[model samples]
Target: MASRVTALLLLGVVCFGFAAAEIVVDCCLRTTDKRLPLQILDSYIIQDAGKGCDISATAFITKVGKKLCVSHHSKLAWVKNYINILDKKKGGHQ
Candidate 1:
């Protein structure tokens, strides 16, 4: 019984550590629930911050003067395409 309790305690500690290490990305907006969907980000300037809430991140400044962070591994097609568009905008081609 004592050994089982010890194992459970170790497991709890490990779980807590993993939870604490989780990356927290923020969508800095005036209202908590209000958000402009990623699809409409085509015209927005998405800049690479080099560092973010996670190791890989892209950021953009909102019209409300908030800096929003996006994950580099985002699975959204629009998000990926928008980044490519931003790259092309930087130069003549991507």
Candidate 2:
């Protein structure tokens, strides 16, 4: 049992190390320094930004819902946080 536990611990450490080794690139949106929905591509916000980064419906859902389109949890909170901030700033202030 002790040996088994040790093996499991080592495996856990290895898995975590591999996870750490992965690289992340900024995509459409930003929260802090992360590209929102690192896994999913959502609507481009550039258009509304009056540029070219318009958020597509697919990307919007993926980013907002954490819908792991590509299985990444990248922009998980940015979309929600952005919406929350917008709500408060726009008319839903609480």
Across 6-91, the per-residue lDDT of candidate 1 in tens digits comes to: 99999999999988774644522221223346433433433333323224444544435555555442644555665666557653
Worst 10 residues of 1 by lDDT: 27-36
TM-score list, all predictions: 0.32, 0.25
Best candidate (score: TM-score): 1
lDDT of 2 by residue, 1-94 (tens): 9999999999999999988773433334432334453244433222122234323221233435443212122344565454454455443221
RMSD of every candidate to native, in Å, equals: 10.2, 13.2
Q: Candidate 2: which stretches are off by over 4 Å?
A: 24-94
Residue 57 accuracy (lDDT) in model 1:
43
lDDT score, candidate 2, position 2: 100
| Worst 10-residue lDDT window, candidate 2 | 42-51
Top model number, lDDT? 1
- Candidate 2 TM-score, true structure as reference: 0.25
lDDT of each: 0.49, 0.42
Cα displacement (angstroms), candidate 2, residue 84, comes to 30
Local distance difference test, candidate 2: 0.42
